[model samples]
Target: VLVIAIIAGAAYYMVAVQPFQRVILSVGDDSVKTGYFLKRMVASQGMTADSVLQSLTAELIIRQQAAAMGFPAVTAQDISDYLRNIAKGENETISDADYDKWFQERLDTTGLTAQEFNKVIEGEILAQNVQDTIGAQVNPQVPQAHVWIIVLDTQENAVSAKARIDGGESFDAVAKEVSLDTTSKENGGDMGWQVPELFSTQISSVIDTLDIGKCSDPVAFSQQDSTTGTTATSYLLLMVSEKSAAMQATDAQLSQLKYKAFLDWLSAQEASTEIVFHGLNGS
Candidate 1:
């Protein structure tokens, strides 16, 4: 009986403990064990394993690359303050007892030790710092277009609208009469001055080639219906009223540019870095 029990213990260790301790990711000399990966997987419930792994890889890369780039240091106090603010909630004050209870409950829910959770928070803070540092480098000025659009439910409607505009009917009058886009239809389809990047991929591709003071060929725009989960295609007739080679971007546009710059930098880092995955297939 004792021999059987000893055998069972050994088997459990080999089957469970060994796999958890196995290295699934290696970046330079640093490694991520299956246990660590599993914890992240649990925290990011509903995401595919590959996506979670990619995010984990990006987080690791951010830490390493940001350090290399001399990004600002994140102190233990910073993490503590973040946690404290969370515990404080909407009201201003929080007592020691309240914080302790909230912290313990969070740990219990996430199934992560205090140190492990703190490490996660640290990674997040570091990633934000990296984004800010890289984002600041984006230029505030960009080529922009002053544009107007008329959206219609059908291609025939778009063609008819174009004909009306071409046949001496005011673009604004036609747009307000037949356009389906509520946001801009009331305002004579005026989208205001904007960079191409602010638009969708499909729209951005054609915006650059459109001649000023002329309407574009009906551009197809596909949209997914939220209630029915069905995709619907719409047609857009666009006119560029004016163009500027170097317009100063708005505050919001500058913010978006900065974010794009940061993402571009991160993508470059991920592309150059060689990461090895071991025992990651089954999970």
Candidate 2:
């Protein structure tokens, strides 16, 4: 009986506990074990499992790319400095004893050991470092397009609107009469100076490529119907009235572009990197 019990326990460990230590997410050669992902799910209160997985994936990619980009390494001292800044009084850093007490409380609340929590802090540091580095590259002046749009409920309407503009009818008059977009329609379809990143994927793809004063063909956009849970497609006709090679970006536009730059880099990394998901759904 004793021998049988020991064998059964060992089998259970192999089936259950061992799998948690196995890699579940991989980016290049870097990986996150299932155990670490679960721990993060616990630490990240109220986040869904899928969201936790995404956060870990982003963190791994950031750490990997940061190293390749020659960004400064995060150290134990750096973690301590982060703690000190947070625990500082009006004039001075917290004393060692107080710092210890606060740190212990944090660990107790999060249910993570020092090592795991330090890894979390290191992830935060690396993310902020990357964001700052990317943001600094966004210049105050960037290429922009002065655009007008006519939003219609169907492709036929969009095509007709484009034809009207092509056949010497005033765009502003047609937009005022037929556009479904109330705000732009009220403004004579003027979108003002715009960055492509601020629009939909379809619109952005053609916005920079269209010649000045030329109208685009119908561009389709899809949205889900909230009441009936069905997808509905709409169409838009775009005309680039002017283009600027170096238009000044507003603070809001700069912030948006900076964030987009980070996402774009991450997307490129994901495309080039060999990322594999394993052991999910018991496979």
Candidate 3:
């Protein structure tokens, strides 16, 4: 019985403990390279393994767990939807095949397989869903407004423009003839459908105090033009065209907020989880 027990212990040590130790030691020896790899994986919320074989095993485990939970597996259609959303945000376009090839190339560069990458993506989606569930309770409504603005290079110009408007010159004509924001000048300085939150609290307060169709006193704003590499202070004349009541938050938006809260909770949970590193000697 003693000999049998010894043999069983030897087999377990050889099969599991020995290999795990060897690979971990190798990672420690190449700590700089391994650290970079681990950092990247951590940033993406991916499991890190000391070797490629361990990485493959970890990926399989993640997939199996996800499947057991009936987590939606990413398909080509899902990838396409993801890409389309990204393109919409960036105002760019790429063919589906092109995106697929590019994605594969990135995985290869990062030493990740399709299954591993898919697992990471699935985890992200699940986390988002969890957040959505938690944030759903807060119904936030953002007030929308239509505004007309006249921007001038200096406070003096702003005061002069306001004086001219008060003197009965047409606001639209004055904006077109002299306002600095050329993009809005053609449309009579109309900035359509802006959320009140888009402006600073002070600016929003000022706008809230003014009645619709009334022009404001000159307000100073500082900005930099990246293209021209120019920095300047400007004064603005704002006219509120309309102020609409805040729109109720949709279910989807509420879910998104919940998901953010869940992530915060998850971070705290991780902090409390135990972590053990063997053979590093606190290095």
Candidate 4:
């Protein structure tokens, strides 16, 4: 009877363990590899190999965090909303089944029960709430500016160009004739309503110091060519067309603000956490 029991156990491992192991291995090496990669993450130079057990623990922690923050638990509706937001953000069509299949595979690999996974989701939602709170504190009604930008290849060239403009040459004609940014040159360098953050520090500072309809001295900025990773020097000539007064936050805008604030907060939290890793295989 003992021998028979041993044989049964061996069979169980053969039928279950091997397949699961292969799935986990394949996921680590290929497309469905979130679980595998997660395990490989090191905390302070130590290995934290992904395991169903770790996932379960993480989920529990997330739940505790949520509860502590007075956030509601995650629900099916929450998941649906999250999925919709993801689809909109990615500009892709994804179905509920897609989310379910992806998460179910993750849960299977991480050994997290559905309830445990929900807890993790709940924690995430709660964390988002904290982010929302921070975002609400930001003054989203900050004014946007309509301006023109003249990009150049060098600082000397930008300075020369600015000299010409200040000497009474037409900004539009000079920009069209000399500016390297062909797209904007044709429009007389008009870059429509943009927030201060969108411009480089030099350009933003210059714009802040100028009145509307005032042209700035050529301010140096850097641009990277995405294809070749080449760094190019550029100059901006800004003309602030309009500046609006601060306005109240819209719900959609508030959500975006909150999301960004949350990310900043999360980064800070992660930086502060005491984390350590050991036995990093590759390292």
Candidate 5:
């Protein structure tokens, strides 16, 4: 029985422990071993063997699918650019020594070789490219609306502005006179034609419920100050002028759709692929 088990283990290794095999998450002619993922996940994240294995499996699936889709490969320059971006901070210039030390520390902590780290970066860039490509292709007919907006720094000012509008003042006039968003204020607060997504979900949901050419009462939301990293509650008012049932998708919206599309595609892959998770519970 012992000899038989040893032979079975060797056979499993021969079949599944390769980067170009029809096992685990093979795509076209590529695969990854269970050990390969376990090493990186355990070393870098301090994750349990089982959890790391699950993540690694999902990661390879996406990368392999991206490769199969013929997405552009990550270049050496791309890796360098990514490292440089990592070294950047809000207001600091990282020296070469510091960057090198930081990079090595990450490798030491994660139990990843430099080559392995490069491959990881490459996989990320490729996956992003795939997502962008799909998103660019997604042309969801987005609903659009025309509205006048008034943004005030203080609740007292917002209440005062609402009072003026309630007293039969023009929303356009009020917005242009007191709005804080300089660009929109210049246009008399006219947001020509916009998707509901132009604002936060709170504002958009409210807009969806308003009647045509109707005004929304002052709604409160918070804005973050980048320099100070502080949040401030602000007030907003909107008056709808026109709307469309569907229009071209914005880049931001397209980005969201693209990720969804990739997820859907990956799910489809799962259906057709043969995956065996040895020793993983409830897999």
Candidate 6:
């Protein structure tokens, strides 16, 4: 009986204690053992084992941030709606039994119980809400360049127009006569209170560099060729009539800038967060 007990204890050590005692990886307080980690790596199919682990760690951090941001609680309806949205996107009018089967399959693939998966989904929803809220708070202060523009279809025409202006031809007359921009040509190319931020980066830079009351030389610009579906270049003649300091951003620009602010905020959070990974590759 003593020898049998000894054998049983040795078998237990070989099967359970020897392999799982060592840490393969960790994300903050959460540590993964070698056995479980290797299984996860295999389940990833093509994804690198380290990347999969890191992604999960980042999600954990995002969840913590979500909690601190006072995001609204995730309800059962939220999860149900999320799944229903998935169904809609997939264009599959699935039955309740089908959904249950899929959900169970997902649990099996993810190696998570229904409760754990629910928590993960809840955290995801909360994190998304927090990100959106932060993005909505971006109020970009953008300057308005009240400039007159003489847009031309080609550089040669634009250059000739500039030269004509330099040779004492009235800019207003030349703009009305030669500017291709019908929108502003009638008003003598008065591009009334142009916000550089609402335009392209190149146009913004050009606008920023122009002196007040100075006329810019013909600047080349590009647009997608609507007719031939190719690259098309144009020229612009800008005269900075009036300029103002930063003002409220336009709707589209505000949305873009706000999203950027949210990303920047999230990037900044990494330094303050306490995250550690202990693994053969991540120590």
Best of the candidates, lDDT:
1
Scored against the true structure, residue 274 in model 4 reaches a CA lDDT of 35
Stronger candidate by TM-score (4 vs 5): 4
lDDT of 2 at 176: 91
**Per-prediction CA RMSD (Å):** 3.1, 4.3, 11.7, 9.2, 9.3, 9.0
2 versus 3: better lDDT goes to = 2
Q: lDDT by residue for model 3 over 86-184, one digit each (tens)?
A: 544565677767677777765776666766555456545554544455455544775767778898988888999999888888778889988999889
Model 6: how large is the Cα RMSD against the reference? 9.0
lDDT of model 3 at position 160: 91
lDDT of 1 by residue, 182-218 (tens): 9999999998998998788789877888888888889
Local lDDT at 241 for model 6? 75
Model 5 lDDT tens row, 19-125: 32323334334455545655666675656666665556566777778767877667898997787677665536777888888889878877888999888788677
Give each model a TM-score: 0.83, 0.76, 0.47, 0.55, 0.54, 0.51
Per TM-score, the best of the predicted structures is: 1
Q: Distance (Å) between predicted and true CA of 153, model 6? A: 27
Tens digits of lDDT, candidate 4, 118-214: 5455656665666666666777776567778788877788888888888888778778888788778998888676666434567767776678876
Q: Give the TM-score (vs. native) of candidate 5.
A: 0.54
What would the C-alpha RMSD of candidate 5 be, to one decimal place?
A: 9.3
Model 1 weakest 10-residue run by lDDT: 274-283
Model 4 worst lDDT run, 10 consecutive residues: 23-32
Off by over 4 Å in 3: 1-103, 108-142, 223-233, 246-283
Question: Which regions in candidate 5 have their CA more than 4 angstroms from the true location?
Answer: 1-113, 133-137, 250-283
